[model samples]
Target: LHAYAQVVGAMPRAFAEAHPKWWHVSLKVTDHGLTTDPMPLLDGGTASIVMDLAGGTISVRTAGETTATIPMTDGLSARVVGERLSAALGELGLAGDIDTDRFANDDERPFDAGAAASFWDVARLVASTFEEHLSGLSGDVGIVQLWPHGFDLSFEWFGTRVETHEENGETTDHPAQLNLGFYPGGQAYFYSNPWPFDADALLGVALPHGAQWHTEGWEGSILRYEELAGDPDGPAKLAEYARAVFEAASPTLMA
Candidate 1:
């Protein structure tokens, strides 16, 4: 929970740097284990943006009582989403900091593999909603990586089709696949140790090609994964990726 709070603290500052046009970003948090119903954070009773970390998944919802939620599985993926939040702040141009006091954590529940499963489900749920919102945007939008819990769903936008692939084969269902990102489970283990945050030996799960870490990029119709073995500066590259994803996805967010 302390680690999550630290990341939460950085979100507002990062968003302020991205798109500094909007006034405020909404914030929210929900957990299945909360003994009492949680309250939404509001400035003047109008819901802005929310960050929900409960049932093992962490999600970010736009202003108003979130009618939509997407689930994210990877802890590292949250860092990417944080980048988007930063970018959204820049777009709003509010010239102030986001109120992140709404972030909630379930301390009663020990962080474990099963708890992590719940977290991934929540992430996929929220990611699906994010895809829907971005698809409807009038401007160009790019989805770099859909890191569902464990597996990485790679995608590229081509006209109306969303090109994607995994270890199995190729898929073109953008919305459907986004929804399916939460399906696979049972393989992930709760990582108690601090995430490597770099290319140092990846501790969670191995990629299909046995690479330690992989990143996704969209170029025309191709979704590319540049896999690296191990580098002393791998952690730095991971940080860069986190910032980029956040900036790219921030436009659609209310925050």
Candidate 2:
């Protein structure tokens, strides 16, 4: 799944309009799986790549009704699949520098259909919860998206406050923000990190559902997915965790 995501991510990075925040490079969750936004074709119309986790396939479809599919099966390297996709795009008249090196893993991993479907279920739920949280906030909020690079689902909310940083004799101002993300890799977990984190003020605040303020390696608050696995109130607990972090950090983030 990770390999496929990387390959699919290359489409937008190579063809879509660049976003300052790199939003153009991420994939959005579809009812069936992850997908790239419609990218303009050289001749006319648009094209998109869809990774259908449930169906266990990656498909490239053009507005002209042309389609090519790559099965998500074991033993296929990312490079091989990427070449197939690149060929498909070429046949459709879309040509650009697709960085094949981004997904150069030759090691093949088994693709479990059931596991993939289960992951989609969890991702869909997380995206919904994140959207709900973002909707209630009064600020510049980003769309809930899946970053193909890290394969994490997340969104950001920019606060009114401006934080300045000096580097190489140059000063730049950036908006204070909060990020809520769910990382499905290696012991899946949810995280909320505030920019320009006020450690003195936030460390003492309590988090619900066994969530903790992590200062080692990276600073942020995290809640393990295992903690909510069988809990009936998991969604509510997730929302509460987000609210806790926002309430505690928003004051320090505001102008």
Question: Which candidate comes out best when scored by lDDT?
Answer: 2
- Model 2, 126: alpha-carbon shift in Å? 0.7
- What's each prediction's clash count? 40, 0
TM-score of every candidate: 0.24, 0.95
What's the lDDT for all of these models?
A: 0.32, 0.89
Worst 10 residues of 2 by lDDT: 58-67
Residue pairs in collision within model 2: none
> How close is each model in CA RMSD to the real structure?
17.4, 1.4
Q: Give lDDT tens digits, candidate 2, residues 58-153.
A: 888776664898889654888888888889988878788999898787777678999998998899889999989999998799999999989999
**Model 1: per-residue Cα lDDT over 1-255, one tens digit each:** 333433434443334223231111212222332111122333432212333444443333344444323333344433444455444434444234544333333223234656555654544443444455446534334452322122332222223324344545754433211111111233421111111122232323332222223333311111012222144443333333333333332322211
Candidate 2: misplaced stretches above 4 Å? 64-66
List the candidate 1 regions with Cα displacement exceeding 4 Å. Answer: 11-51, 62-70, 77-79, 89-113, 116-255
